[model samples]
Target chain A: PSSGIEKPTVKRFESYKRDSQLPQAIGELRILVDYRAQSIILPIFGRPVPFHISTLKNASKNDEGNFVYLRLNFVSPGQIGGKKDELPFEDPNAQFIRSFTFRSSNNSRMSQVFKDIQDMKKAATKRETERKEFAD
Target chain B: MAAKTVQYDNIYLNLSEKPGKLRIAPSGLGWKSPSLAEPFTLPISEIRRFCWSRFARGYELKIILKSKDPVSLDGFSQEDLDDLINVIKQNFDMGIEQKEFSIKGWNWGEANFLGSELVFDVNSRPAFEIPISAVTNTNLSGKNEVALEFSTTDDKQIPSAQVDELVEMRLYVPGTTAKEDAADGEE
Candidate 1:
């Protein structure tokens, strides 16, 4: 009996090799979508933390009262709705950052950030699908 | 002889919305902003410990006081470490510990509760830390999962435009034993 399941291959991605390579705009302490690096830099406390585009699940933005909130969801284990083939981790047992939400009074900028993340995710997914098709 | 006062301009006090001038002398430390009527000062005797680390703005000097929450002063260039170290040693007789941060962009890490902070360490180096006091709510979102909501209100007086405030964070913890109180009778 053949079980038609294939093992998922681990995907590897690197954001930056050195701290000095981070963009100068990170000094503003704002969420920066770096197209060149294919990563999003988030200001955690006083450090600019980067998340590669491959790790992102999705991003969303919404307005509430006087502020707008931007939420970033990362791919992690135990997710229910996503396809089984979409599990992209090298080790499913590893601890994961499930999500992060940031709020700012700058609504327009938050919207742009959300859009940029979605666009990047779409491009990455399309590229992955094309690669798989070519392999087939 | 007059006291040797080291002054650094364009420093932010406690991640303030605005930058100010910081002066370190034998008497104490003083931070003044153009918007403030009086300068904020802390006597040398009140200082317990201080640390230097790379920050988004450049560098941060965190001063832990004897009887208050620690104060963070950011915006020091990397070149300023030596002069600041000498000033602290000569004036306050205290050494500044250099805290190294992990630059690896990995999302997975061990979240350790340290004092009043939640330190997330990657490969044993701190990736980032969150103040436990700022967390407004926590809930077990799922099995072995926890979600923490932070108060994004400008209660710290940090300008909303200056920094993107973290509102919420979710973590996945593995190997959390399900409440085995019921299974105890069977086993």
Candidate 2:
């Protein structure tokens, strides 16, 4: 199971063939919700700029192939909002996270639960279109 | 814009560096673990303040949470912390089931690299502290990501942010000539 997480293909755009009109100035991003191969493409739910997440340097899996590790940098979408709550971290929005991934490149583990990493690119494109008309 | 949600693997505080403070991110290697559903990242786009200092033991991480609304989720009471932990753990479980990282774009992580750190920040106090008692290097930077291992309260030497806002969208579409490039590559 040393092949924990599958080797990542070139971490590039969601398949330009699907949408060949993207500009380089940067408009939207692809978010691949990959849970052991199953991936889903989530369109940014809010804001002109949909919240974007992507893999940074690389993803490493454990020797047992039961775990996958990768460094991903997140870009928070909007401005500062809300007051401090009675929690350890004052920002109420700080801990009220709605979604994220716990990835393991573990190969021994078969069958991921998410839809498919291929859809991540689609999610980004959808955001670009939505942002053209919305903000949150 | 709609409400944004993210997730993390660990929730920790910096004892020796910033005094009284805590941060929540994921436990996976690389910065991607903390990304949200459409997947939000812990980018330092809007963040203005950050620090990583050395102390008697390992290091200290400090970041300020933005206060925009009337109620902030920073510094919880003992009960709140417990509740928070439970909630996060539950979120973790729920995420595993959904296999979407986070259902609503949020993720949670608990410190797992071993070592120890005592957090010392109450309600709204500025300086917070943790019990990171491992001797180590402590630096700060925006471009650098946290180490790619199961970090304990000790093995940390990276810059922290009061808050970092990464761009919501990375503009995924390729240039107009993208198809040509792909086609070329395939050929």
Candidate 3:
């Protein structure tokens, strides 16, 4: 009887936009923690946006009333700190990918999401260690 | 020592470039725009990191310098992009070597990029490999950040003196380290 039953669909983390507005840089997204790929996938407007586990530098959460605010450090390779170009031109920072804060429905759900992120980071580190061991 | 030049539009999200030049020199990279008075020259040593990214029109080459802001060269034909990466890779190869200790004290002993692992041989010490993914960033300019941080790896830390030597070898951008040399010299 158990073999005849179909498996339940895997539920990815979905954001609740009741009181808080989403950031313009990152529009509506359905976040999925992909352990195999070692990345977090956010399908934004039909496009699958992926953030590698390594780029996630920091993560923190604050629970207030019925909601939890999750703060994420999105570190990009582009933010370099330097002076303006000699000819009065624009100089963009290299290592300063902005930290994003989003509202989730409850502490339980937000904690689960944070745990998933932590898991991905650990998995990435583990993979690197394995590669190094093999090379050695 | 070949000097190859390619021209493309430097596309920004809300802006356009009217045929910019990318000159590949043996020692470094040169980029110039029509509005700029002088062509920007970035020695290979100054380039902290570089990567490719997809853009709305085509692809963009992002270069992060140690002492400067990140620059994006956009709208490249696929062929041109291939050529650019090849040239840069060649330059990078020249910088890497086995058993090289050009700098004082700290010894590279033998280091090679084997696949994605940066395998290192430090003289009598056991050789170790560091996965490229473990590196969060590089210090090209030797100013704010250390030249290389092994904290990304789970391995035991080398003596602080050795770490300093590695920084001197990998991160020193010719002139900036002079300011900190006195303090570093004390140790």
Candidate 4:
């Protein structure tokens, strides 16, 4: 009962090698989507934490009253609707940051960040699909 | 002669919205911000330790106090490290420990409870840390999943209206029966 297709291996991605390489805009204490680094820098308690594009599942933005909220979902185990094998993790048992929810008053910037994350996700998925096709 | 006070400008104290002037002297550390009417000061006797690290803004000087929450001053340039170290050494007779942060950006890591902080380490280097005091609530959302809600309302240092704030974080911790059994038997 073995299918001919093989599961795709998880590819490792890095955001930055050194601290100096981080974008200067991170000092503003806002979310920054660095396309060149293929990462999103988020300010958590004044510390800039980086999340690589590969770890992201999706991003969304919504408005509530005067503030805009941005939620970022990450690939983790025990999700309901997705193929478990499709999303590979470097270590399935290790602790994972499942998601992050940040709110800001900057509505327009939040929308732009949402769109940027969507575009990055789309591009990454397309590249992944092309790689799989070539491998086959 | 009294120890000369070393001043660094454009430093953000406790992640404040605006930068301030930070002065370190024999008396201790004092930070004055134009936005706030009252200046913050820390006495040398209250100082427990100093940790220097490279943060998103710039260099960060984290001062761990005896019985209070640690104070973080960010936006120091790399060149400021030597002067800051020398000043602390001569005045406070303490050394600044240089801490390196992981830039690999991997989500999976070992979460260790170090003193009052929950440190997440990736490849043996710290990715980020969260103070246990900041956690307002914790719930077991699902199997092997725990969610932590942070206190956003009570923080007087950083204005909530001016910055994007992290409200909650979910962590996936695998279960281990052996450790659980040992804890139960000991109790």
Candidate 5:
């Protein structure tokens, strides 16, 4: 108590960076369908704000068992099209799927939605560990 | 002709009422204010969307009045519509309540996009319906050829609560413009 040194338990507005490869925070993905074509777009929120659109694959309304996946990294807010990368577009009609009636997505409530996914992953990991131990 | 029954493609809740989380995902309610309704009027030029922009994705807001078995179910009663209207009146301010919405984007301040303003009350109760009629051109897939949402908002978070509390009601306007287009050709 006599020493003028303080404990380093406080955080916020300060930090030190090290070799950290922690997972990234995923944002929302938007999907839209035109008369005969479909387009997918990703809006990333981070350091380098990137907007990517997909080429219209032979897509339609009734087609199921399909997915449009996107990853967002490095998006600096308040800036337009911050340095970023993207997948090529399949839809020919769109310069980039500008905007359209947003189709359905599974991220309505973000917090619990993503949390459930993470939880399932953890459960899978635990099961995998158990199975390995049993084999040993 | 009998009013055909419409099935909704999506039905979800919005918890923007939680403290500090201003705009709910999917249907970002606050993307633009009611006054901007002026600039969104006709002769479409691919302008900015009011609130239903991509920034507000993943959030679902709807107030559905369904009747699977009209005799036994909570039928689409006049009280139901009025109740929904009352919910809208309380959530949004006076500016929102009077912001006239139409099935056409012709006159001034008419909608040119497919979205609605889910005005929820400070008590986390959904209270308004800002129907968007500019959704015709969009070729959205699924049962709800058209989409709509209902929202409940609050200034603070209710501890241990779920997202359902934020979006207290819902309704889907499917092929809403299909009927409007038929009327558009005439007076």
Candidate 6:
């Protein structure tokens, strides 16, 4: 245990970046928000996909204020698909950052939902710290 | 026979409890909200937990999924909420554990119920999820927030992600949606 190296603190957000294109059909899709659950339920074709609120980096209304866009960043593997820098969508540890835009005719309903999420974001961070303290 | 349907209008938008039918049958439960392009359905087996609480305006029916976050629907009379609970109990084996709670003004910030796990996130800290079973007890102080006590003897860890897949199911509460629409009109 004599030879040791200290671990790094404060991970840089840029290192988590990964490239992936959103499908064309994503524009029409609706993401279900379980406000109490603090997760975004993505309505894929066959079934819905639920991602934790922690995975989301930022969420806001798109330009023209008619839609809501979300930025989700999650870690993935470093090497996949025989490519060094690309995220293969199947990488479990790759930091995939994808932005999703949802269009709704009723802008206000969408805005309120987004607002609720904004509030939830602050609350989620608080919970995270509490657990970290307990874990330590 | 056709499924029994309960339709309500101007329910909370968050609950997806629009002026549509909440159809409950032997197969499962489904709701068609005005905002959604299509109806969502959930099979009986996937439900993990359920809770009913009285909000400022009316009753809220919260349904937690085994693989997804919990959802709540508002805009129900107490009698109808009771009836819906009875119908679900009599027909389906939802595998849900019920709890008595009333969320007073978002005190604990959004606590996400994912199956047996509960996740909460606050400022400047990482989010974490712990199993509900691991939680020994919960106390509600006068400050309008819940204090959960967990046993550290077992060293339980929080899950980083949720399980796969979600069955389509929809519900809505009219309370918040109406206010949001009014705000839009004023602006």
C-alpha RMSD for every candidate: 6.2, 22.9, 19.8, 4.4, 23.3, 20.1
Query: Per-residue alpha-carbon lDDT of model 3 for A21-82, expressed as tens digits?
Result: 22222222234565644555442111223445654656777777865666665443223542
Predicted candidate 2 versus true structure: per-residue lDDT over B88-121, tens digit per residue: 3442221101100122122221122211321212
Query: Which of the predicted structures, 3 or 6, would earn the higher TM-score when compared with the native?
Result: 6
Please provide, for model 5 over B1-187, each residue's C-alpha lDDT reduced to its tens digit, 9 standing for 90 to 100: 2212222222112222122211212221222222233211111122122111111222222322121100001112222334333333343311112121111101011122122322212112221223222112333333323222222223422221122221111112223342333222111
> How many backbone clashes can be found in candidate 4?
0
- Chain A TM-score of each candidate structure, as shown: 0.91, 0.23, 0.54, 0.91, 0.24, 0.52
Mark the regions of model 6 whose C-alpha exceeds 4 Å error after superposition: A1-136, B1-13, B16-19, B94-98, B102-187
Highest lDDT among the candidates is held by which one?
4
True contacts kept of each: 0.71, 0.02, 0.00, 0.80, 0.01, 0.00
Best TM-score goes to which candidate?
4
Q: By DockQ thresholds, what CAPRI class is model 4? A: medium
Candidate 1 interface RMSD (Å): 1.5
Question: 1 or 5: which has the higher lDDT?
Answer: 1
Docking class of 6: incorrect
Clashes of each: 0, 115, 10, 0, 38, 32
The alpha-carbon deviation from the true structure for residue B49 of candidate 1, after best TM-score superposition, in angstroms, is 2.7
Candidate whose DockQ is highest: 4
Can you give the DockQ of every candidate in the order shown? 0.63, 0.02, 0.03, 0.67, 0.02, 0.02
Model 6's TM-score against the true structure? 0.32
TM-score of chain B of 3: 0.41
Compose the digit string of candidate 4's lDDT tens values, residues A9-88.
67878999988789888878788899999898888777788998988888888899998989998877766665754757
Candidate 6 structure quality by residue, lDDT tens digits, A1-136? 2246533233212111111112222122355565545656553221123455655545656534543333332322221233342222322321122333344445665676677677777787787677556745
lDDT of 3 at A61: 78
The candidate with the higher TM-score, 2 or 3, is: 3
DockQ of prediction 2: 0.02
DockQ versus reference, model 5: 0.02
lDDT: worst 10-residue window of model 6 chain B: B178-187
User: Which residue runs of candidate 2 sit more than 4 Å off their true CA positions?
Assistant: A1-67, A76-105, A108-121, A130-136, B1-187
Chain B TM-score by candidate, in order shown? 0.85, 0.19, 0.41, 0.88, 0.16, 0.47
